[model samples]
Target: MKYDVIVMGAGHNGLVAAAYLAKAGKRVLMLEAADEIGGATASVRAFKEYDALLSRYSYLVALLPDQIIQDLGLNFETISREVSSFTPYKKEGKDFGLHISRVWDKETEDSFIELTGSAHEGKAWQEFYSEVEKFAQKMAPTFLEPLRTRREMKTLIGQDSTWEYLVEKPMAEVIQSKFKDDLVRGVVLTDALIGTFASAQSIQSNICFLYHLMGNGTGEWKVPRGGMISLVNELERIVQSAGVEIRTDAEVTQVSTDSVGVRVQTKKGDSFTAEFLLSNAAPAHLDRIRGKKSESALSGSQIKINMLLRTLPRLKSGADSRRAFSGTFHINESYSELEDAYVTAAKGEIPKHAPSEMYCHTLSDPSILSEELAQQGYHTLTLFGLHTPAELFETDPESSKKIAVQRCIDALNSYLIDPLESVLAKNSDGSLCIETKSPLDLEKDVRLPGGNIFHRDLTFPFKEEGDAQIWGVETDDPRIFICGAGAQRGGGVSGIPGHNAAMAVLAKG
Candidate 1:
């Protein structure tokens, strides 16, 4: 078969790329290795007996550009959380927490004062984020355009102090200097470490932090109306409507490119040729398929736990369970502890106290549950344990996974008035309604190379001086391009890479 473009994965990014190309009158074929699509953005009924749908992998919507949704006319929607985050702690023999709202309010101000022993920290928090908001407002729109040089992006942002701390220096310096409280510092730092195995001092953390906050200008992590799958299904609908051909269970095993065009061979021995090929798979995976040396990257360093709870666990802090669980709940994730966990994990040992955070998706949108389940007060909790890298599970994977899961549970229980296990829904077989995905499991299930969620370490969303690439999606071969998370500015649930790659191909004609 021949096509104007062949997208080598039916992941959401591939779907987005195909939708744009087909809408532009190109003949595009999208092939998926898996039996179904969505990649890490899938939502599934983890428990067979329950009617609850859980976002099995990536949960929140942050980096996806609103322009893509508008351009593609996607019917998907995301709802903002009423609360931002609640971090519980034990201080001087008393249990308390810091609660913040999505929009600042007096109650949030009181909580910050109570937690930090004054209103000064909260004031600093506002000032720091306000500056970041300025930077985001300037930079968010640039993702869909051709790559800007670092100096040019800095100039465009036009905030020298903001750029100095966020771009030039390590994130740790600003985090520490801005927030005096340890827990407050940790809360700020968590954004830098999601799925990324890096210390606060690493410039890598700065890149991760930038992407986390630059989404849609506001950087609010919203819940998809149904689940993560809603975005995929909508994109699937758009691509189909645009007349893009799709093939599941067709894994592209080899890719060859020449001046004329590109050719790919699937695992089933099926072949296809295209004037241009876009890789929606990781760059490392693409390199292997193209018979080139793959580059090394940090292994994915987080464990994802999905649970169906009979009731939301009450916090020892005495905050409203509804408010606490609705937003991000931090456990054992203080600044010092996060760095310590990284040091321990870097040495190939699971942290004795694994730092984890969880939120109740059902709190934001109960529509994912059946009427009976919702009426019964059942909710779904998704927990992510950080710093448990793939290397830690290399020996006795199952045993190590069990240990990591238990550590996360223990950490959560420390601040809960009711133990998490007791509130968990049970299956007909009496097994707990919960599951954990180690980094190894992600690689096996989704091919996220060592479970690195961003496909590799994320790069600054710009080009270097004297770089020749226009769209930042180009590879060494003109006929080949990256249309996935491996592309520059192509991390998270964002479809920027797909849009850019399509534009790159269109420009050639």
Candidate 2:
């Protein structure tokens, strides 16, 4: 069949592109390899015995633009978190932790002072975040518009020193120069390491740090009200209502482009042709399917663990368990510790002290659980372990996963009064309610090459020399475009690439 545009994947970005194209009065067809859409944004009944819906892959919402929600009239909603983060520490036979609240009050400041043993560090924390806020404000608006040159972006930032530190220098230097406390520096550097395998000392790490902070102009990672699936469900509705046809279990096998248009053939012997083709698959995956040589070296590093607990684990720090788990809970993720783990992982060994983060989704929104589960104090815990690269598991996938999961649990246990295993809920069959996914598992489940969550490592938002202006979704073939995380500024849940791809197609006239 022939169509105006053929979108090759049903990921969030592809759905966004298809929805916009269909709404613009074009006939669009979206094909998916899996039976359902959303790709990494899917929420599934991961533990059937517990009656809980876990965001199996992508867990938070921060990068999606408000303009897309308003333009599409999406029914999606996210709850703002009160506590921003809590990092626990052990000192001189006593347990203490630092808490950063959304509303920075005296308690937050006191916690920082106590943990760092310096009131100066507490003051520095405010100053550091204030600078980040300014950076977010300057860069957030550029995300929705066409790609700018480096010079243009620097002009918008308006401060030579700020641009030099944030954009020109390595992120490690910025964190070290600004924050005196190693733990505080770790907290700031964590933003640069999310899904990125590079060290904060690298220039690429600066790009990752900027992308993490530029979310929605606030850098606040909000929780979707119903779960990540709600966003996908709403986008599916918009696409269907706009008359876009969607086909699942349609694994595309080939994409051939000519001067006039493109042709797509699926493994099922079905064929499609369109004037324009949009690929939501990883650029490397698309190259493999299209019989072309791939150029990018992309891999994801992180271990994701989903658990259902009968109750919150008691923290040694004596903070309110609900408050501690409500936001990002850091485990052994201090600055020196993070650098050590990175160095260990680079040496192809899983860090003994795995730097990880955890949060209880039920603490913020219990809607994902059944009423009985909620009443029974059952909650969902999503833990993410950093610095465990995909290569660590290439030799023995199962053994590496087992070791990685146990190390993460052990790291979390050091901060808790009780071992994490003690509070885990059990199935009727006596199995603990826990699941772990390594980068290898993600590659198998979602086709994320090397399990890299942001596709290839993130790219700078500005255009480089010899690149197409405004849009970064263009490919070597004029009729073909990339609308997935591999594109420039195409990481996280943001629909910018999809939106921009459609805009590129519309501008072809």
Candidate 3:
């Protein structure tokens, strides 16, 4: 069938693009390789025996702009986490922790002072994030607009020193020079490394860090009230109402662009023709299908572990479990440990003490659990193991997965007064209600191309000098565009790429 636009994936981004185009009176057809949609933004009943719906991948919502929500009239909502993060550590045989509130408070200040032995690091923390917040405010408005060159963006931001440290210099240098405490630096640096596998000294980390902090101007990571799927469901509703035709399990096997239009053939023998095509698939995946050599990118380097805990575990630091697990729970993620883990993973070995972070979604919003389960004190724990690149599991996924999961458990146990296993909910088969996804597993399941969640390395949001790119969603072929994480200024759950791609197509009119 001939269409105005053929979206080659029904993930959230594709849906966003399709919805926008369809609403503008363009005929759009959305296709998905999987039986369902949502892509990494999906939420599923990972533990079937349980009544909880877990955001199987990409749990938090930080980058989604309110503009998209309002424009699309989406009913989706994200709940803010009161506690920002909790990092537990043992100093000279005494257990302690640093607890930071979402908004600056005495508890957060006191916690910082207690850990760093003064207000110096706390002051640095406030000043650093305050600068970032200002920078984010300036950058956020430009996300949905055309690509801005580095010079243009810097001028627009108007924070020369902040831009120099944040954009020009490596993240490691700024982080090391700004914060004195290793744990504090690690906490701050974690934003730069989430889903990205790069050393702090690498420019790649700088890009990731920028995206992490620049989300919606505040960079606040919030939990989707009804799991990640709620956002997808709202997008689905918008697209369907806008007359977007969606076909599941319609994987595009071949894509060819001509002067007239683009042609697509699916694995199911279905054919489609469109004036323009938008790919929500990773660029590497699209390149493979288009018969082009894919670009080199770092393999996905984080492990996702989801668990249904019977109850939250008590922390060794004596902080309230409800509070500690409510926010990002850092385990063995000290700055030195993070660099060491990266070094180990780079050498093709999972770090013996793999750094990970955990959070309890149910704590922030109990709606994901059934009334019975919520009343029974059930909670969900999500663990993300860093620096465990896909290559570590290439030879033996099973063996490596076991080792990686064990390392995460061991690390968490060290900081917990109550053992994790003791608090885990059990399945009907006598198995614990826990699931793990290695980088390799993600590739097999979601086609993430080497399991890199950001789809290749993330790029700096702005363009270099003399670039002709407009929306940053443009491709070599005028009739095609990338509307996925592979696009510049893409990555995370943000709909910027999708929105930009739609605007690009609309602008062509």
Candidate 4:
């Protein structure tokens, strides 16, 4: 059946595109390869270890366009998360709590300023976020929402100055020049890896944090009250509510665009046709289909890992530390250490001492499970091992998986100064809770490119306004449009990519 639009992959971006179009009275049909929707934004209950809604997406509410939430009636599906990140750094033998969440009220701010102890710490926190709040204010509405031409973008950000200000100066250099403390610099530099496959040392690694920074237009990251998946479920409802049809287990095999429009062939011998098509899958996956120019824009791949724990980590902050689940525990021995890990991964080898970013949102929201597991002390943990070399699994996927999964256990043990005593249990194998899931796994499942989360090496430095990606609205083809994280503004849970992509199409009218 011919449709107004066909969204492939049903990832958050796909769903976002479909919903927006459908909301505008367009007939949109969303399809997924998996039995359930949500590409990376999905929750996998197939494994008991991951039964609860662990974060396949980020918890930042800042970058998400609030208009979509209100317009689509999303607040009913998603709960507001209150916890912000608290990174604990061990100095010498003592542990320090970096309470990253900003308490909105003046009274709480004063109390926190006092609790922070050092004047520098308090001011640094305030200052960094203050700048972020400023730039990010321009990020979403003015930057993220609109789909414009290169000339239009240049005019908006200022042609000569914007490139020099945003792209030319890499994020790493910004940290070295701006911040004094290595610890503070370390914390801020880590933001660079949010959606990029860049090492902190990469020419412009920290630039990805622009989206991270912008996400909280006000510079505050609140977790969803239930878990990260709550956002996905809510997004799912938005798609459903818009009367957009979604089908899981319907893997798309190929896409062919022509004078007759687009035909999406599924793995199960089913073909869906549409006047306009948007692929929320990774760009690498899209490459396998019948498209050339559209597939070249993406970059990089990733390795994802998730862990379920019996209790909050026992850190130097104290065995029962309130900071255990404050946000995420980024285990980095030193700045050089993290830089080296990224180097090794870039060469296609998982580092023995790879720096890990553990997003422990489960602790922030005690109710990760549907209900039952929440009653138990079972908390979910997201251990993101970025820059894992795709070649590591070339000969032995199992070995790489084992090492990749165990690194979290080993890293956690090192951080807490105690071994976990074999508490790691796999969800499916009943061995360990750590699982080695990568961009390859995602690509195999949904057909995204190189398993690159943002569909390719999403470098903001390269997003020139005239570029199809910069605006993320228009596609090379007349009717075909580029939406989703793979499009312009790139990854994170922000539906801006899809939303803006559709707007570009609708605006053509």
Alpha-carbon runs more than 4 Å astray in model 1: none
lDDT of each: 0.93, 0.89, 0.93, 0.63
Q: Per-residue lDDT of 305-423 in model 4, one digit per residue for the tens?
A: 66666565567655344444555556663456667777887677787776667656555666667566666666666666655655566678777777876775676676574455444
* Stronger candidate by lDDT (1 vs 2): 1
For candidate 2, write residues 447-469 as lDDT tens digits: 99899998787888998765765
Could you tell me the lDDT of residue 446 within candidate 1? 96
- How many clashes does each candidate structure show, in the order listed? 0, 1, 0, 22
Model 3, stretches more than 4 Å misplaced?
none
Worst 10 residues of 3 by lDDT: 1-10
lDDT score for residue 303 of model 3: 98
What ranking of all candidate models by lDDT puts the best one first?
1, 3, 2, 4
Screening candidate 1 with a backbone cut-off below 3 angstroms (N, C-alpha, C), the clashing residue pairs are none
Please write out the lDDT profile of model 1 over residues 1-509, one tens digit for every residue: 35999999988899899999999999999989999998999999999999998999999998899999999999999999999999999899999998989899998999999988899989999999999999999999999999999999999999999999999999999999999998999999999999899999999999999999999998899999999999999999999988889999999999987778888999999999999999999999999988899879998999999999999888888899999989998888899999999999999899988898899999989999999999999999999999999999998999999999999998899898899889999999999999999999999999999999999989999989999989889998889999999899998899999999999999988
lDDT (Cα) of model 4: 0.63
Report the Cα lDDT for residue 156, model 1.
98
Clashes of 4: 22
User: Ten consecutive residues with minimal summed lDDT in candidate 2?
Assistant: 463-472
